[model samples]
Target chain A: MEKRVLMKGNEAIAEAAIRAGCRYYFGYPITPQTEIMHYMAKRMVEVGGTVIQAESELAAINMVYGAAAAGARAMTSSSSPGISLKQEGFSYIAGAELPAVVANIVRAGPGLGGILPSQGDYFQATKGGGHGDYRNIVLAPASVQELYEMTIEAFNLADRYRMLALILGDGALGQMMEPVVFRDKEPIDLPKKPWAVTGTGGVRPHNTITSIYIKADVLEAFNRKLQAKYAEVSRREVRAECLNCEDADILMVAFGTCSRIGRGIIPIAAAQGVRVGLIRPITLWPFPSDVIARAAAQPSVKAVLTIELSCGQMVEDVRLAVDGMKPIAFLGRSGGNLPTQKEILQKIMKMVGR
Target chain B: MQAVFKRTAGLLNIPTHYCPGCTHGILHRLIAEAMCELDILHRTIGVSSVGCTYNNYEYFACDMVQAAHGRAPAVATGIKRVHPSKSVFTYQGDGDLAAIGTAEIIHAAARGEKISVFFANNAIYGMTSGQMAPTTLIGQVTTTSPFGRDPDAQGHPINVSEMMATLPGAVYVERVSLHDYRHIIQAKKAVRKAFRVQEAGLGFSLVEVLSTCPTNWGMDPPKSMDWVAEVMIQQYPLGLFRDPKLEESK
Candidate 1:
């Protein structure tokens, strides 16, 4: 039997990252994300790793860039305002083609709105958060166990694709506690980064890591290459969990903690004489749009309802995915407010005319 | 016949984009000579910051990483933390280090990151065509300070070495120049000492080189060199601001 340990979502992700061979962590203090930094400071030292409580988020992300460029599995985590500072580094990392992981333990904010949980960064996560024609591999984990697993996978996916992978979580997911089991992962044989700045040893020609391409034509070519890689990721990595999606009167779409709310609405709506189903997205970047299209295409699914912890962010994706196959309804509560399972059920029942 | 001096392989023998008589070329050679002398080129990682030398990564024969403006020191700290045995350094400019990247450099020094920082202080933002700089002399005129820098309005020029000397983590802080043949030789020696301080893991080491931007300064090559000696040095004095070895001897 595997040993079970109770840990906060942030700690679980931190421990999983260490298990995934992330030896360097740079972070700044932010509520709901500080536990990850604390865990890394203590545990990283024990495992012969390094963790720095950086001076600022801007400094932290740049440090991650340097470590990643030097061929280390590096990571950083922060809440909203701090993630804003990281945008500059993310753009450079994407342009230079380095691999790294970052987690945004989101708090309420347009500008330091509050420290409570919020999922207002969906567009920022799915679209480019930084100034560029690039996107990060964004993962949305609804449970602590899933958060742990995805944190480990984020490293592998980042290196495999040679880009950034963002684990987008809210303050609630970061603070909540759950029993997590530590599973020994099979050794992964990732390809060595021959392009990294691991000193030339005087034998090999020195490698240069940079994001600046002065010529317009050269930069365009590099951008095209990034687009092709993103296309491949979309084709290969779209993941969603569908529950009773077929033969339902209504289908609901959601992600992260709200997706769990989307699932609970099932039983409540069923008891109220209306059949409802759900599609919980795992990879928010390579969004499971096709899954939504399929579920909404079912003859019995009359309408699609999208629920969120923000004022209709993922609803935009659902609208894009459903593509007029079914009429869509959006129900959201922004500014640190979460709609209850029963409240979501009422929205679903209203769609089904119950 | 025995070869007395040949170019060092620490820097590649490639043409640079620097203007004629620009002091960046001289500073680059001094750093290359130090790398060759210390036998650390193969294991050294250089971080090139933004400015005219943003692309210096291409000239350095050792592995190089080009960092964003003002973030080179933080980046170097990250590299050194991971590869403590390998040597790491950041080459930055007045605007990049003293102005935009002020926080990063200050924190890196405060933490005593085991890395070397080679600062080139030319008193103006040459790449941007002579904008004001944090280390600009009080009366110097640049595009931003058209009527000459007024101490009351623009604030006093920052003495980088003197400020660095106050930090305990900064084990070696020296202000050098390339105004003439004698000063050029002394500047090379200071560069070597900066690298040696890092080699000995003696915390953060910085060597601020008083460089020239002749084109932006609107001066002829020789006049620019003379200006550095006769004018620039008055505000940024040439001397060692901090050295643990000197302290130990005392």
Candidate 2:
């Protein structure tokens, strides 16, 4: 039987990771996400797991890299500035195709912006922030329920794709407390990892995990194979939620914490006699562009109002998805300020001439 | 009626790609033989560090993972923690282990991670050509230190083994040189001892092998060996610096 509990988003993610068989947790304390490291530190030891408070964010992520390479379920969490420190390790993990979970409870960015919730890191999360041509499987959670569910899914996706999985949340989401019912208490049946560095034991030949392909042709071949895997993921794993867009005039595209605000504005716009629908992207990387394009093809959909907490990061993807068939407008308040439902409704009224 | 020359039981018979008179070949043989003798060859996982021997995975007859520059220690720590039943070790070069990977090795040791570290100190970066390394002698001249290593400008050379020995978490730490046949034997013993400590599930063990880079040293193979014994040893003395067994006796 599933148990109901009142938990913050950060605590929920930590619990979900433990129930999902994550045994190693390495992290450094940072705002809005410190509860995750605190929770894991107390719980992991009780369950015969390991929790390490690394010296720095750089050390924490490398510890994750180490644990993941050893075939253990591992994770780390931090905010914007801390995540920046982890970029090098994250890139190496991605390049090696090692499975690990990184939770970014984003605050304002571009150098220690603020400690409040912001979606400024949308571009960094989607586009590989470190050196090299690589991609991370980014999962954007809109609520406490999603914060728990997506963390489990993040581990699964990371293991499946042999890549880093990011749980992209914000300060508001991490700090909010809500009722959450776990899916099940059943033990997770992880797939066998034949590629991990868990020793040979004479059962098989030695396996090497590496990203250094010096020869041009060899590296080219590796890049082609990686591209193929990415393509497969994009075709099969793109996910998003569409709310009441069949007969709507304006389509509102948002994700993460911004999606909740967009959802809140939905009824307000409807009461004002302005038709507005919300399209929330669940997976930000293998983006749900196909869904957006299909919605844009509808004759009733005239414009896409992209609401975010950044200047215009995710708005670029919405514009690309809409493909100029409909005019795309953006409304945002960065550096820790959130757009309220009243502000969103006013923007919709201005757009629809209500 | 019997084979006069045969490949070592644990070592792969493939001819090594190391330059003539390179000590890496000898070190590999020692590790392989140790694994075979200990009956842990099948259960051993080697994490290869970034350097001239980055492709060491091809040489070891065990599971291997090639880590990014300075990350092998972290990788080995991961593998060891996950599969405690398996023997895990990292083979790193002076530049890879002592310079770029200083933090990684230091933290791994401080955490008392049960793994073996084989630090090959040639005092120069061989893979990238004769560049000055962290362990490069104070007066040494290389491509990057053509004016000779200036103590004020380039900083002083680091004694990695001695420094590591001071850490309380390190159960075993030793410095050995492959300058002569006798010292080469001692170096092999040190390597084997480090592996043995890890196999016994003791805390972090490290063996720093003072080696010679003949091509980079601008000397012939034999002359470089002599230089290692006569000069390198003067700056970086070789001997056991820490041993858990010694502490137990007291």
Candidate 3:
């Protein structure tokens, strides 16, 4: 029987990471994500793992860089401002092709915006906030259960692809309490990291992990290699869910907490004798552009409504996906505020011209 | 015939890209020698810091990872924590460690991270073609400080060895120069001691070697050596600044 318990999303994610064989965690405190670090600090030692309260987010990410290079399952977590501070290290990790798990329990931001829930980091997270050419395997969880499942999946994907896997959450999901079931997962068989810097022992040639290539040809080739990997990921990984789009006049697009609010729209729209559907993007980077495009091409769908906590971010991606085929409307509540189901229903009705 | 003096196997038999008269080669040799003597080269992981020696990973015959600027200490902390029984060390330049990575190095020392740090303080950013570094002397002339470093404009040079010694977590702290053969010998000893301290599970250990940038300094190798002894030593004195083992012995 799988163990079921009531837990906060942040704590559940941390516990799931431990169960997934992550042995080292380095992090600093930030609102909405502090519980992740606190739980790790208390439990990692009991499981024969290590946890460190790094001096800063910069230090925390670099520590993760080190631990990953040393062939350890390592992770770090932070909020908006703190995640911004880790961009440099993220670029380094991606360039070096090291495996790591980075969690951004996002809050509103252009700067030190607020401690409330927001998805304002859409571009920064998907478009590579760090310098150089790189992209993270960004996963968005819409509930505590998804948070636990995605946290484990992130480790597998990171090790499988030898890339940085990011969990993009919001303050709402991070702080919300929910009943979660811990299922026994099959043991993940990760590839042996022969290139790791865990002592050469003179048994083989020395291994080096570096991103610097002074020669233009060499740097270009490295960039091409990264592009090939990303292309493969896009082909194999894009994940999203569609609901009630078989015969609907309007389709709604959202993710994470916003998607939960979007689900409320389906029931409310039905009672009002309206047809509405939703498509939640679970993997935001290798975004489900094809699905959205195809859905928008359907005859019954008149428009696509994108609801987010930011003024407008994912809307651009939605537009890119739809490519002006149908009218794309956007509704967002920024500055750490969340929109209500009534507000969303009202916006849906307005877009449908009800 | 037997070998009287030969290169240690700790270093790969590759011709380094270092400029003539640069001490980076000498520093690499000293570290390689120490690793061979300590017999931990096989179990050692080296973190190479950014700068001229950013690619030192090619020269060392051990598992190596390149770090961004002064994040070497933090990287080393990560490696050491994962493989505690294995030795971990970082090779960083003065500009990388003292200026950009000050927070990383300071906090690593404060946490008493069990790793060895080999800081090469040449007082100028050699890779970027002669910019004034945090360790550049008060009146040291560089591209950025054309009229010589102005105290009013550039502020005073930081004495990292002296500053780092104040941290309780630093178990071994020493500053040696590589201006001449005799000083180079002392530097090798310092490098060995730094690694030995790590071997014994001591806290953070560091050896700050006053290196020379002959190309960036616009001086020949010989003249640069003399300038280091005659001038650089005046602003940055040499000797052991901290050693907890010495304290416990006393």
Candidate 1's displacement at residue A2, Å, is: 2.3
* Pairs in steric clash, model 2: none
* DockQ, ranked from best to worst: 3, 1, 2
Across A1-354, the per-residue lDDT of candidate 2 in tens digits comes to 667799999999999999888998888899979999899989998899888777678777877887787788899899999999899888889778899999999998789788999999998999989988888999999889889999999989989998899999999999999889898546698878888877677787777777788799998888888889889889988889999888788999999888988888878777777778889999999999989989878888778899999999999998898888999999999989999888888888878876
Residue B112, model 1: Cα distance from true site in angstroms: 0.6
* Candidate with the greatest DockQ versus the true structure: 3
Query: Over the full model, what C-alpha lDDT does candidate 2 score relative to the true structure?
Result: 0.87
TM-score (C-alpha) between model 1 and the true structure: 0.97
Error of 3 at B5 (Å): 3.1
TM-score of candidate 2 to 2 decimals = 0.96
Q: Write the per-residue lDDT of candidate 1 for residues A1-354, one digit (tens) a residue.
A: 888999999999899999999999999999978999999989998999999989999999999999998999999999988999999999999999999999999888789888888899888888888997998999999988988999999999999999999999999999999999987579755569999987888889999999999999999999999999999999999888999887989988888888888888788778877788889999999999899998899999899998888888889999999999889999988888888977887677677776
lDDT of 1 by residue, B52-122 (tens): 99999999899999999999998998888878888999999999999989999999999999999999999
The reply for model 1, stretches above 4 Å from the true place, is A188-190, B1-5, B246-250
Alpha-carbon TM-score of each model against the true structure: 0.97, 0.96, 0.98
- Residue by residue across B122-222, what tens digits does model 3's lDDT show? 99999999999998998889999988999999999999999999999998999999998899999998998898888888789989999899999999999
